[model samples]
Target: MTPPDQPPPLEPAELSAYFALIEVSSLLRHTIEQQLREAGDLSYVQFQLLATLGDAADGSRRMTELADGVVYSRSGLTYQVGLLEQAGLVARAPSAEDDRGVTVTVTEAGRDVLARVFPGHIEVLRELFLEPLSGADVRTLDRVLGVVRDHMRAVPPRSARSRRKGAARRRPAVDDA
Candidate 1:
């Protein structure tokens, strides 16, 4: 750990503030997760994955890209894709330009599922969160979160050594297979 006197290291309070922000976000996220899980039979991570694909131009995203953006490994995502495939919610197809890279596309059944649940989900958010916020509050949140998102994306992914070190400390038994 870097010493407090070092100019490069952020202060303890700064680190605490960062943690508090994460906690606050997690608390809010839990509410959405619970609602989605109970009401729609979807995990928060699954919902994110589905929504990301559903929003794509062709409703298809490459496996590696999807893995990076969502809370799943390439293999774990492949498993989820297989499950979704069995459920008739999505289909996998080889990329035309590169046979080595496959893409998962939402099926018509997936669209039907999304259509059934999306409106209700939006309503839940409106009731639980959005409706209470003033217009100014909404705009301010949009601006601030946009800046934070941009800044966070600016940081490059960690090197393998750093990633392994952090993952080890967290004790996350990630099933890469």
Candidate 2:
């Protein structure tokens, strides 16, 4: 008999799928990170930040938006943005909509960096991640991943954590027996 507190074990196929997803993600990320570093001297997170801002219609987004879009902690995003600002790759300005808000814009140099690295980035993705799949397989994978992404994103992102009520209080530490 199973204990009530213990959840049912994963089915074999479920376990295999989860492992494959994780391994593929790790492998793809490692290659992409290397390409970003070598081609643009940018870390993956930094590249994500720049790409997100570059895609914006106005080429600017609020700090919180960037944090949410990049799925990064606000503190970490702030530090990366600071580094980019120091490098003259991006600029921060007060948001016109809200006095307390900050807007970050990708500079021409940032755009230039994106342009330089994007070809190699796409190539790495194609060769390592996409090339093995057929057209139908690619479409099915895209659809499945999109649904998973949407399901996961349904939860409020890390950027919203600080704004939640009672989030200011630290949780009591747990004692391990």
Candidate 3:
């Protein structure tokens, strides 16, 4: 028998998986944040911005692109980038391609910081995240999460008017016959 007014609930296995994901995400972030702060005197967002710029082909990205890549608000990213600029870890300049846009690039100093922080960061990741998973488990997790990410990205958030508008803006144009 079921209660008429109540909505269907997740099965136990589904609930367990959901909660585990949430808990693991929170715990991992906390650990990583502490490690970053202690090792590099860097906040997670600052580290993320530096890392993202470091990985770019030109070691630079447009402010809008960086904002989307880091899941940060444009204004917040501007403030963070300002701090990085002040620290001499990054530089900002008017975009040559778009007069209205700004490009952010990591400095030699930023790379130095990354080099200093990387060893410890890797150790933390290996200890907290990788050690518990077998090779097969790692592979499976990667594949599963990739699918989930693609699905989620394809579907706009509830606040958005439609997936088409949001997803289209995020992805490059493609022609289909």
**lDDT of each model, Cα atoms only?**
0.73, 0.88, 0.84
The segments of candidate 1 whose C-alpha lies over 4 angstroms from its true place after superposition are 1-20, 156-177
Residue range 1-177, candidate 2, lDDT tens digits: 668999988899999999999999999999999999999999999999999999999999999899778777677888999999999999999999999999999999999999999999999999998899999999999999999889877665655557667775432221000
Candidate 1 lDDT (Cα, 0 to 1): 0.73
Candidate 2 residue pairs in clash (backbone atoms < 3 Å)? none
Ranking by lDDT: 2, 3, 1
> Where is the poorest 10-residue window by lDDT in model 2?
168-177
Worst 10 residues of 1 by lDDT: 168-177
How displaced is residue 133 in candidate 3, in Å?
0.7
**Candidate 3 residue-wise lDDT, 48-154, digit = tens:** 99999999999999998887677676678889999999999999999999999999999999999999888999998899999999999999999999998787557
- Candidate 3 deviant stretches above 4 angstroms: 1-7, 155-177
User: TM-scores for all candidates?
Assistant: 0.73, 0.90, 0.83
- Quote model 1's TM-score: 0.73
